[model samples]
Target: MDLFKSFSTLAKAVPLACLAFGAQAETWKYAIEVSQGDIQDLYAQEFKKRIEAKTDGDVKVNIFYGGTLGTSADATELVADGALQFANISLGHLGSFVPEIQLFSIPFILSENNEVNKHLMTDSTTVYQGMEKGFAKTGLRLMSIYSEGEDAWAANRAVRTPEDLNNFKMRILVSPLQVEAFKDLGSSPTPLPFGEVYGALQLKMIDGVGQPISSVYQSNFFEVTDYLISARHQLFTSAIITGDDWFDGLPTERQQLIRDTMTEVTHYMMDEVPRLEQEFLAKILQEKPAMTYISLNEVQRDAFRARAEQTRQKFVQMVGSHGQQVLDGFLAERDRLEQQLN
Candidate 1:
């Protein structure tokens, strides 16, 4: 049977959907904080539009974007604490609670187009039905997942290989697996909140940052970092979350509306985010003819690939046996979805 089938069965054992079409007189505050004028800001605005239309304004989703709510780790923790109701959390922040989320840090695991929908909606989805039950005690409900392509580097210097990344202190979201991998690369990595990046870079507090080109462009980091290098170093994905107890109180129809709507948003984002990123970057450079875009040689890329495998091994060891099983199932589902994409 397919992974979705398994998910359906699992969801059925939990609660029925399709009973929550009506809107409730509730106010919602969401945090998306990735800065204001970059590529992600555009897509985030679109998502807000959909949510508004879906609820017809009865439910308001206030965006505490650009660190008004908190950074990646704080977003997850606040949602769990119920201090915040909704958030867009990076998977790498899983170090705070779900270390298995680290398995995706396995280098080139998601560099190709084949990885997009691979993990969005399968039985091995981001947070499993039973596993999510654990979050109930913490007061959070893992909601929709949106795919992000592999992350690259934004630096002041040209980086074509992992060796080049050596001694390159970069700012990465605080994750034990990622921190160690960067440390192994001969670079000093300091884990910090996303909100602190701009000032840090401006102050020369760090040397470089590892993120997708889209984010770099969206957050206007290209303004600070003169070089944009496609290291395709790591594949990253994100999860949308809400309070678990709050989610359970919603009617089935309302629940189904979100499930179906976000599924559409997922596909939309998969195509739109990347497409817009290219346009934005092009316009950015065209406007700034003095900027540079570094191209990595094939041999160097392969060297980077070698490091990817080593990183994956580290993740498996770091996450432990139970975490490995989750990784296996997620990869299996990811491979299947890749076939469909191909």
Candidate 2:
């Protein structure tokens, strides 16, 4: 009586072949915009290998890296329309389609890798079920959420408190929650596509960006920015998504194989991405001795957390009843996990 078992029974009642019109082995395309060396791209490649091997070639996953399929927004559309089989979409970009996913954008909720890893490893938790239920409403099947790391602020200037962030034009993905959160932090957030970020920063179009350590390194943002602030304001989470109808059409065994492979890969990433974060941060500091690293004091950190709680309240109002249900469950689960960890 697990969620997957319930899905399997539902999948059996429908003819998946009716949607794709073939009984032959299926080949799925998983799209991501990062280069191969980036954390997300690496995980996509690993998911592909594990899935195809587990299914013994009965199911094949092909990865389209470097935005071959399109931007993250484009990837979400492709998955929903059933043209793309899978994608690793950021919660910010995903909020446009499913507002409930924006809960992950609530700053300081999962402030450390350990809290994130807790959610990543436990699939049967209330938060996990709530996330799956939320995604189902948007017609996307949620395979799993991978911990990308806590978001830190990278900019051309140092930031130690909310006052230091005044008037900074920060780059953010297309999420209103992000827009509101940064505005609360005293910055003007400019929503931009990830591909244009590098040039924008180089041209002084944006003064900063908030992203995980792996992204700051992999995207070469560290080279352009002069400061790295360990804000750890939000846990950067990404989803492995596919069209619900297409996934339901999949034979139950193939569905199980996909889910199992995702679980394996999630655990692997939980270990690997943190290690990469350390290595990347060290490498960045080693190469650019002039880059400044700022660690916020408790009072400064608390200011951001207070702003985040206010932002979360605004979001609860925005999504109304449905979002409230998920947010309540998520916060409760977060408290339980925090207690367990402490």
Candidate 3:
């Protein structure tokens, strides 16, 4: 009788111990607007892996991909409300919430040189210092901003000059700056949801889209488009963000771990992007042999560059003096980085 009672007590204690262990583990929810294997997904996965490993499984990240939880806008709100722990959203989409973010959408604002652009995105004070307060005001902790690739135009027709884009209905992010920028280039800018882009192109709802080369290939936009124009007008930048309150509530050590891990991931992404751009473009061509690739010469690109000033003026007008200050700082940083690189 004594032995049986001891055995029963041991079984009960074992389950209690297991329950306590499970209760101590933390599960963080991460949201991304792209499907698995996309650049953002890769970033989220790497972050999840690093955090979990560093925490020794005390923290686990559950990623909700392809807007499984909701759209990018919805996910942003969820993060701000503390319903989600993290989200990777493009600056274009974020412009609606924080208009100052539109600085990034201005035409040719970033350097064409990959190294300069990488440093601007990763290490620039304009983003980490200048824009951090704007993000915090909206209840988000801006963790890191990184680029996927230079934004390219995928169209049904070849475009070599600004005149070639006349009346070209282009699918743009729902950003006022993008609308004005494309308008300056003589294209009718149509703001559409990212998911609806491929179908809209197939159904002829829009003419072309400006996106990173990887997105064009990963989303299979190449199937519906005929030409890939290497415009290099802007870099496709995305930010990793979390709820301001949630991040602040964490222990100081955990916060430092997250910051350090994100910096590592940012560097990882910068290195991976150049290789991915080449691989994705090759795959796009292999699958679409009839597709044309157009690389505009400097003289041809100079035409588009001239019109960028008009868009920059419009950006300052929309965001006002604060926007101008941020823009000035960003331009100064870009210039410094370019000079250093040269």
Candidate 4:
């Protein structure tokens, strides 16, 4: 009788122990491979803070920065597999799904803050739902979009005209849109990883690269590239994501808590990115003081813009039925948002 009583008591304690540990589970782990200086890192910090504040110790968020967990491509796969609870990665590198994200790298649709913002914030046929759909099928998700600053061309020499670009070799990501755009302008684009870019430029393999000014500053590309064109070619962004299975398994309240906190985190991220963008652009001038910053004349700007138009048409065809509608829907939604902005 005594042994039976002891066994029953132990069995009852097992469930209690499990509940106790569950109550004290630390914050979720968030991974961003970018440096502490990057916007995604800032967002991760804000998310950690907000989730902790709201959950009152029930949840804590742990973070890793500077590719500590994995490269961006690997991060996406890991997050989908539920090996990672959360991550922020560039949609560009996740070519296995969300192919429409490539449209951002296109020369026109995402070339400016207003246009990109319109795409993200505006409501219409343009919520990137297809991206959400495709990611769902693969066990990843779309949590939020982190702001990436406007892009520019940094070169060894002053690139004043289309003719100047044609004579130069540039590093471009191997996306179809980028290849076609560079080819259209007469420059041959070589696809290389961001880490490899500095070496390529040093070895005279590439005469220039198109990138955000802040990225140029962070990587110290200003040393090799003597000039910058505030080309603002595209507004870049990263996707915050989590394992779909993990997200689906969470209690409804916990899901809401995370969603709400992440929104606050996004605001902090939005403010921080633009602030850093301006700071770096200004620093580039103040620090080096000798590097030329190219401001395109209105006529030159229009010429580049004109060349980008056909590329949009190309995207519709390239993305096929799903992406074609996304293209059409985005354009109409973009027009509406621009109207609201005006």
Candidate 5:
């Protein structure tokens, strides 16, 4: 009778002990190297919320925003090495590590229709799959890929045609494709770090910077530049990435949770981008009435597109045959989806 009572008591206490130990939750740190008011910051905060709630606090996300960790490049390195668990990285920053990524940055590669964003999300999209596969080889998993809007020209003078771009020194991302594309378009592409761009523009070191309207608004470039031309050139694609080793180490359910949560965030950002573009443009119009905001007509847009096409081979040569295969697959898928949409 005494032994039976003792065994029953021990079994009851086992549950309590398990609960106590289980209280120690799995924690992760997410790093964002951009400014606070940007869309990526918003996505990080919401991502934290969703992960915690969905996991019922079993998993916790700690967000370090505004380069609290380090510069964007530093953060990306940390994430790739698994020192940082997650990061939101611009495609340009990723090209050096995964040359195949440079394909997406090629000028005028993506369609203007917002639905093109949605099409890339499908699992069967060849280029998207290829990029994800390529990223895997570099030890990074691409959780989400979406547009933050298109790149625009923020110049001291209005740039209406290719001639206007001649002799113009423009700030570009560090991607070679960007340099080649702008060079073909008759501008002197000056690749500069994001931090140096504002001072460079103010000092007339560079004549203009190419970025999205949201970026111009966030970076306060509108105060320094007099023209905003909607190039819609290069749909700026960004990816949410995590270290493959770290992700793979997680429980299967946790992996799925993160993937699903990020997918939801990507879709939300896609819808948010155009609206934010309008918001930023409206603010620019109201505050800087003298700033010229020009939207290109079909003929002008075609001219820019034709020039961009000339840079495609340059990108292919940079990445070689494998990269060309990815580009061809993406173009075919893009065309197929576009036709279905029409």
Candidate 6:
């Protein structure tokens, strides 16, 4: 009887002991705008796994997918306001908060070579030195920016040339650069919130959208649009951001762990995205046999490429001297990285 009582007492005391020592884990929220299995979700999952393991479960990450927490803009604002711990926001959506980031929205700004684009995103001083400061002003830390894949245009009709896009009524992100770029490519760009895209397509409110292959398949955009054009005009980029104040308040070791872990995840995403793009494209075709896939040849691509310089100028004009500095630095870094790869 004494032994039974002692064992029961010990078991009851264990809970009190943990409470007394303050051994409770911290739960952090990570908001992503896409559904599970999308690149952002994949990145979040990998980050959650590594961060939990690294911290020995002292910190836990809860991922909110498909705008459950809110839209991309809402989630980003939450992070900036320190109400949310982390979020994965596309540069397209982020342009509203930090307009200079619209630099990435310029068509064909990144290299067609995936390896060069990967290095540019990971190591470019323009991003860390120039764009990072822009993010800081918004009270968010730019953890890392990574590419999902080249943007593929899905339209109601085939788009072999810029002429085909004339008055096509395309759905574009709410970025001035995108609006200008598509206008230059001869489309009537309609900026719609992401959630409204499918209905907009089904209702003919907009003709089509340009998104990564993974996004088209995952979001079921393949079902709504008739053609998937691999224009490769731009790379779909997303930033993993966190609350600046919250991140800065962390201990030095914790901060380093986060930076190191984010770097690792960025590299993994860069490598994994290309493969996933191909896989997703195959799935889109298999599921929607009637949907046509258009791959623009170099000559055909050049037509769209020719219009890019005009939009690039428009970007600098919209952003001003500071934007000019970032754009110049970005192009220089891109050139240097491309040469190094060669």
The Cα local distance difference test for each model comes to: 0.67, 0.80, 0.87, 0.73, 0.82, 0.87
Candidate 6 or 1, higher TM-score: 6
TM of each candidate vs. truth: 0.82, 0.87, 0.92, 0.86, 0.91, 0.92
Model 4 over residues 59-173: C-alpha lDDT tens digits?
A: 8788887568767777778888888889887656654476676666667674244444634632233544657777788898777765666667778878766677776888876
Each prediction's number of clashing residue pairs: 11, 1, 0, 3, 0, 0
For residues 1-342, what per-residue lDDT tens digits would candidate 3 score against the true structure? Answer: 999999999999999999887686799999988887788888889899999999999999999987688888899999999999999998888887778888888888888777787677667787788777878899998888888887899998899888888888999988888899899987899999888899999988888999889889889999999999997777888888899999999999999998899888988888898898898999999999999999888898888999788998898899877877888889998898889998
lDDT of 6 at 194: 85
Global Cα lDDT for candidate 4? 0.73
RMSD values for the candidates in order, in angstroms, are 11.7, 9.9, 2.6, 4.2, 2.9, 3.0
> In model 5, which range of ten residues has the least summed lDDT?
119-128
Residue-by-residue lDDT tens digits, candidate 2, 149-251: 7688789898888888898999988898888888887788999888789898888899998888888988889899999998777667888889998999988
Q: Which candidate, 1 or 5, has the higher lDDT?
A: 5
lDDT of 1 by residue, 1-342 (tens): 699999889787654444354435566667775767553455466667887788787766667776676566677778776667778777676555767656655666553663445344323554466357555656776666665544667777777766776678789877888787776555678777776776777777877887766677666677777777775555557777777766667799877766666666666777776676577668768866766877667787787676656676677788777666666666676677677767
The digit string of per-residue lDDT tens for model 6 on 1-342 reads 999999999999999998879877889899988888898899999999999999999999999987697777789889988888989888887887778888888888997676787677766788877777778888988888888888888778899999999889988888877889899988999988888898888887888998889999988998999999998888888888899999999999999998898888888888898899999999999999999999999999999999888997888888887777888899998888788887
Q: Model 6 residue 69 lDDT?
A: 78
Instruction: Output the lDDT of residue 196, model 2.
Output: 85
Please, what are the lDDT tens digits per residue for candidate 5 over residues 1-342? Answer: 999999999999999999997788877888875788777777788888988999788788888876588887888878879998998888888887888777777777776666765667534356556677778888888777777777888889888788899999999878877788889988999999888989998898999998878889888899998999986777767778899888889889878888788878777778888899899899988999999999988898878888888788888888887767777887887788788886
Q: Which ten residues in a row have the lowest lDDT in candidate 2?
A: 115-124
TM-score of 5: 0.91
Instruction: Determine which window of 10 residues in candidate 1 has minimal summed lDDT.
Output: 114-123
Model 3 spans > 4 angstroms off:
1-24
Winner on lDDT (2 vs 3):
3
Runs of candidate 1 with Cα error greater than 4 angstroms are 1-25, 81-83, 114-131, 148-150, 184-186
